[model samples]
Target chain A: MKMTKIVRTTADVFYPFCLVFGLYVVIHGHLTPGGGFQGGAVMATGAALLIVAHAYEDITGRIRKTAMKILEAIGLLTFLFAGLSGILFHRPFMANWMAQTGKLFGNTVAHGPNPGDLNTAGLLPLLNVGVGIEVLGGLTVILLYMLSGIKEEKKP
Target chain B: MTPFLLLQALILLGLIVTGALIIAFKDLLAAAIAFAAFSLLLSIEFYILQAPDVAIAEAGIGAGLTTAIFLIAIRGTKRFEEKE
Candidate 1:
């Protein structure tokens, strides 16, 4: 295969791996180091790769810019809601509100027989997910807009 | 002599090199690519420094979104210029 073809094939394989790895980082954020922001950025890179390798028209057809914008906004609102709900409940902002004591996915997070279990922890995980989605969607929208703009410029 | 300190020193060196390269490079496109690398390295440094939240934000906003914007801007501008 030619160099360009090789690059395209590698990107095609790498995109799925990036997406899966990104999800793993986001989901296991509580126990591990990576979180939503990092994961989301990683995920967005997959989209970036696709944009770089494939035609703009093809990417646009699959990923609607308007929908991505809406999703991004919703993600931000979800994060805000999670934070404010803690304040409304007389807890600190972004406090851990979940049970936090039980076992989650076979991992003993917080100590048992107490309210501070890992499973029942506050809203950090949820917040992480929200932030991840927001970052991914927002970046996608920006990239798409820029690409479309470039296409339009080339046409005239 | 500790491994942790060694890692920190390496990350700091990366940041400095990236910053210098960004300033020294004449090509805006190259600088923009370096900027993304800078962001990623800085995020790693942040993680090592125990500031995961800031690191995450930097990785996403700085590395991901900012790079995309820069590339777009570069496409809109002249590709090359005489060195001054």
Candidate 2:
């Protein structure tokens, strides 16, 4: 059953905020209190908000299970490749070779009592993004699967 | 006690109340809402204790997603518990 118009509208209004805040947490994982899992859960909560606001048939079209599965695979691959990159750099697996390399997310960080820089986290932000996407896809897929199971049960 | 401590105590009281309410309510939907409230209060407690990471996780997964999932389950099954 679909929820009232007020719930649907409120979810629509808040969804973007959830996405943006989740991304912020993922991007600033090294500097902030939250990391990939929390951010991804927040994003998935946005998806859940939409899922609960609409009926099963109406929501499945918008948040396809296949797409979420593919997204989960992509996220895992991204994290795997990021970890494997350390081997290419002649370092141990998951090494901080990217740190202070003056490259992507590789800037020198100042000592204590200074403002934190986004580029100072080396491979952390990349890892955060990977895990964030994976968790988002995984959790949302679980919700979708549950909803689909309900649909099947509702039939004869 | 200081004001901060007093506020914390109040939140702790609320947690106990909501936790009990979850078990007391025969309406599954009401119980689910109480569970969400319990989670929200727990997250606040975590925040007060200087664990923002856990706080965010609790707020997102426990309070938000769990409530949504529970509501979905209740919709699929039954809203009120059957007297055994």
Candidate 3:
């Protein structure tokens, strides 16, 4: 228990730094080896650290079960919506619609200074973000159920 | 060896060790902690494998959330005792 406290404190102190680094991983994922999912998970570690340090009561009050459930549902729906949008636009499912927009940092990234650059990859970044959100939300719900004290009844 | 590969190997080793401990340990609380470690290590392995999405899912749901649940469950149940 004493050891757990020490570990928890260290992790809590380390969380902010981890969050920043996780964002970097997500934003630069297209250029590097990481993406939204990886970064989001890393971000989740920050929450993990807090839970360990402060205990579940402290954390649960901040992140209500109702909100988490809503986020999970929304995330899944958003992902499906994106796919449907592609179909509605007369394109195949999961078509790169952002390619038509042809903008980066508010302007066209392709055919600009960094032509055919990794940053210019159409719709991939957005897709990555969506996937990340969905994964995070879904995982959170699963974890919540596991953490909640609802037990299975035994039969005589 | 690349840093990514090195991390990957370390995470995998941690995962295996924790998994073994979780199975071998009779104490439910210790086993829960070991399982949490297993989840954390698995997340790191996922990151090293260039699957950040999966890594995040594992870290949040597997390590962070699951550990909390285990702690609560432990509170609700009887602690493990040695067999006579």
Query: Of the pair 1 and 2, which is ahead by TM-score?
Result: 2
Tell me how much of the true interface, by contacts, candidate 3 captures.
0.48
Which regions of candidate 1 deviate over 4 angstroms?
A1-3, A87-95, A99-120, B1-14, B40-44, B47-65, B81-84
Candidate number with the higher DockQ (1 or 3):
1
Clashing residue pairs in candidate 3, if any? A37-B52, A37-B53, A38-B52, A38-B53, A41-B56, A104-A107, A147-B69
Local error of candidate 3 at residue A152 (angstroms):
14
DockQ of each: 0.55, 0.70, 0.32
Q: Candidate 3, residues A40-63: lDDT per residue as tens digits?
A: 666656655665566555667876
The residue ranges of model 2 lying beyond 4 angstroms of the native Cα positions read none
Candidate 1 per-residue lDDT over residues A11-84, each given as its tens digit: 79999998998887777676665788888888888888777777677667887898889889988999999888
Instruction: Report clash pairs, candidate 2.
Output: none
Which has the higher lDDT value, candidate number 2 or candidate number 3?
2
In angstroms, give how far residue B2 of model 3 lies from its true place: 15
Model 1 complex DockQ against the native: 0.55
Q: What is the lDDT of candidate 1?
A: 0.79
With candidate 2 superimposed using the best TM-score fit, by how many Å does residue A16's alpha carbon deviate from the native?
A: 2.7
TM-score of each: 0.76, 0.90, 0.63
lDDT for model 2 comes to 0.89
